[model samples]
Target chain A: MSFTMTKHGNVVVVDVDGQLIVGNRQELKQKVLDELEKGERKFLIDFARTGYIDSSGLGVLVSLSKKIREQAGELRLADLNDDLKTLFELTKLDTLFQIADNRDRGLESF
Target chain B: MAPVRERWPSAAGSTGDPAGPDAVRLALQLEVPTDVRLIGRIVQLVSRQARELEFPAAICSLNVPVALSEALSNAMLRGNKEDPAKRVRIRVMVDPAGLVMEITDEGRGFDLETCTQDPTTPANVVREDGRGLFLMRRLTDRVERYTEAHGLARNVVRLTIKRPPPADGS
Candidate 1:
């Protein structure tokens, strides 16, 4: 997956592309966790190009969310297509997450 | 081996067809590592098909289509050797009662009963890899396996799902 980190003030807007599968899970997980450690907890994930994310990828999201919340900050996801949106909803994560409809909305929340 | 001819049983019966076939054949294909794209495609297919066929509200609530994608990920990522040429056949069949999804790989099958246990619950939730089966079992009804007419031993999985009540119980 290809990711672009554009900083809107403290909010790290991550634009991701390609299939977010098992192959690149660790890298993505580490990158997000590392940023969270650096005190950049505000995140807006754009799934515009992300084709798929398996359980591992979902784990990273859950783990990262937990970590960020522990730090008193938050990770908000935006632009989740129908497929990914259904996944989070099916898993009952829509209730747990601060999901934004678009980038403007996600960034505006911060 | 037999060139893979999948035919829908005219109607559900104990003798000719399966225990029952609320399961309608949605699509069939050889699953490859690259076929991960099909994951979303399959989920989308099931949603549209189920709605058009008027299967049941449970079909949507149980969300077997989503679980099917995760199962494919396990078989393609861990089960098979990840050879592009080593294809895994995916069959998604849905019945009014529920949906049955099967992914037949060209590799050896592993033990299901062992992996079904949630090792990480109170003991080791921190561990990885063992989580896939946990998620699958949690999402689908009953995940089981047996060889199709192809006689492909120990390399196939049959996940049977009982339709769930509507999320809001409507």
Candidate 2:
């Protein structure tokens, strides 16, 4: 997976593209960790272009959410396709993090 | 001559009678080394067939490939320890009732019950692992694990989707 980081007001937006799986999840995790090190907490991960995700991807996102929350930072995901949305719901992860329909809404929420 | 080896019931055969007219049977078997890149190829095969079978939007779009990839990853990573010398076998069978994906690996198997920790818990949510099993169980209809006579560990995941009745009107 690849991430392009931008700022929408105070929320940091990380747009991810490509398949998010075990082989590439670590790059996304590291990006989040680097942002955390920079003391930028609020995060919005835009998944509009991501075609697929696997268990490793979910685990990475969960870990990122917890780490940000522990630091009093917020993380919200946006633009998940129907398939990904269902996956989040099926895994009960929808209850764990804030999910929005679009980047503007996700940015506005934080 | 050595006794002919029969396919195991635990394999990805039809839960219902496969010969029935209503059953649209499609099967594919793949044997690959413990390489993560090969998973993309398997996903492509599964996703293409699932789409052709006209499975429901969700089943065709995500669940099948995701669950199958997880099973394959486990077979490659945990079951085979990413050993290039080892091989992982993946069998996918689709029938009218549902789809069955069986993955076998050449390695010493662990106790599935003991190894899988619930990732949904508050304390364990941030562990960044062990969620593969959770996702497989949640996404598929039924999952079975066994140690075959070949000293291989086989993980079978079955997903039930509603398919149209046979075109001939059986």
lDDT (10s digit) by residue, model 2, range B5-110? 4442322343536545554668788888999878877887887887887776677668777888788888888888989898888777776556767788876666
How well does each candidate superpose onto the true structure, as a TM-score?
0.63, 0.81
Return the lDDT, model 2, position B160: 39
Model 1 CA deviation exceeding 4 Å by range: A1-6, A15-41, A44-53, A62-110, B1-38, B55-62, B119-123, B126-128, B147-154, B164-170
lDDT of 2: 0.78
Query: What is the C-alpha local distance difference test score of each model?
Result: 0.66, 0.78
Clashing pairs in 2: none
Estimate, for each residue in B1-170, the C-alpha lDDT of model 1 and write its tens digit: 67775555222322465434354445444444535545555555665666676656534533455466677777677666666666767766655445667787766677776665653454434333455676677666677765555555537777766555556987
State in Å the error of residue A73, model 2.
3.0
